[model samples]
Target: MTLDPSVVTAFTPTGKLRASINLGNPVLAKRDPVSGEPCGVSVDLARAFAERLSVDLELVAFDTAGKSVEAVSDERADIGFFAVDPLRAQAISFTAPYVLIEGFYLVRDDSPITRNQDVDQPHNRVAVGKGSAYDLFLTREIKTAQIVRAPTSPAVVQTFIEQNLEVAAGVKQQLESDASRFSGLRLLDERFMVIQQAMGTPKSRGLAAATALQRFVEAMKTSGFVSAALERHGIAGASVAPAA
Candidate 1:
């Protein structure tokens, strides 16, 4: 497939494709324990996009999704991987999602919050990763529960424990992992929301960049590249999103 030079330039203004890698979102990206290098479906997708553009790939690592979004909004990153969120759309032009993951509530095993629907209560204090899709969604959806923001997604569980929060909201996989690591924690069976993981470019990059990104994502999905990437990375709890 021939890429338009203008689109390529817009995605790589500095002549290298700088992708903001958010390690906090385990479904998208993770740190390799042995090498400390970033890996996972998002990393694979970024590498594929850089290869398609025939540009050198530069991974701008950020520990949190909020920082990753800021990096792209500030134009420090040519492109970024993020959960498609309306609140973040003000600064980013997100393509159709390439992967879909679930959001859930984590609570103490003996806590009264027995279901996802029970999370929003008058006295409930919900802990969430600052600026994440969960935080943004819950901010708009929860009318009663007070939200306490943690510094990052991976820190949400610990923050909940440390603060004695009634409920913790985050990626389902991360919460599940936390449940296994920490005793007395359990994830609600029902999902609170579905996270649409997508690639984003700065809004200032214009329509061409957005169109190119959307096409790239759809092609990756239809061509089985996304499925292959997930399999290759051994990532679970996420599926290739339907073509948009």
Candidate 2:
């Protein structure tokens, strides 16, 4: 069967950021529980991208971020619309970040590991998604925590809620949300790895498309359009750092 046109554009109905956004995080994807339609910050941003492109908006949904990246790699989607890291950059070309985010550590609010440094102490069993940025950051930068890979944030929460683990790391936004679900848990100190949230295109796609998207995203940044989109979705604080 012919590839759906959305596949060619990385799930964007139009081949531009303004026309669409697709994501792997369903919590953020904002699905209509009844119609199962895609909705959320990612979808809204994609719509903004389409509007900037002067095209119609469309969003394709994926259940997980990893699968969203796979869609881009396999030409089924245009972008994953989430945090970008070095490994992902190697796998897919990315535009300059439109939002700056930080990774975080979460634990029971009453846990003794109150500071970021405490997590590094011996036998501190920290849970994190197997292939997630939290895993990468903790394994590489956070030398103190003994990592117990959980494969997904919810899974980590499951174990933590059962008192099976002490500390865990994940995206601050996701972790904070999970913390709300469990009364005992809360996000710890602001220890976070500053990351730029960017869009992706297949690596095989030449520099032209990637560069063009980057430039367009930058222009949107300067024009304050991106900020408007973020506020529209209640993500007011997600943006690039102001000039030094």
Candidate 3:
């Protein structure tokens, strides 16, 4: 796709496209075991978008989604991959989602909470990664449950254990991995939410730039690029979003 020069400039005012990548979300990105560099589905998309803009790609890496979102919101980075949330959309214009992932709740196997709706008891304290999609979503949706925040998503389970919280909320894949590392923990039979993961640029970038990004995302989804990336990266519990 040939974008207008203005649109390209909007995405790459620094001559290189800076894409904020969050390594905190294992399903989206992670440190390569051998090379110790960032690699995963988000990295692939960032590189591809930079190429579409015909600019050098500068990956600005963060260990948390909040930090990554802040980078793009502050215009420190030109673009980023993020979960579509109403709060984040205030400063970032997101495309239709390119991937869909589920949010789940985890608890000790002996715990009485066996269903997603059982988590909102007045006495149950839930652990969540501060400023994550889960945190933001649950903050609004969960009325009775108290939320305790961990420093980052990867630390949510540890925080839950350390604080003796009743529940840990996070990505299904992440919580499952934590369950394996520990004992006597199980996920609820159903997911609490479906996360729409999409590309975003600062709303300051203008409508034309946002439209270009939206088009890019839809094209990638329809072309099977997203599905291919998930398979290549061995990412389960996430799937390509339908074209918008």
Residue-level lDDT of model 1, residues 108-214, one tens digit each, is 98998898778788899999999898898999999988999999999898999999999989988888887787898888889989999999999999998898889
User: lDDT of all predictions, in order shown?
Assistant: 0.90, 0.64, 0.94
Model 1 lDDT at residue 99: 91
TM-scores for all predictions: 0.97, 0.78, 0.99
lDDT of 2 by residue, 40-110 (tens): 65665566555544556546565555656666766666655756767667778877777776767888767
- How many clashes does each candidate structure show, in the order listed? 0, 12, 0
The candidate, 1 or 3, that scores higher on TM-score is 3
Which of 2 and 3 is the better model by lDDT?
A: 3
Off by over 4 Å in 2: 1-28, 50-58, 240-244
- TM-score, predicted candidate 3 vs. hidden true structure: 0.99
Who wins the lDDT comparison? Answer: 3
Ranking by lDDT: 3, 1, 2
C-alpha displacement of 45 in model 2, angstroms? Answer: 3.2
Instruction: Between candidates 1 and 2, name the one with more favorable TM-score.
Output: 1
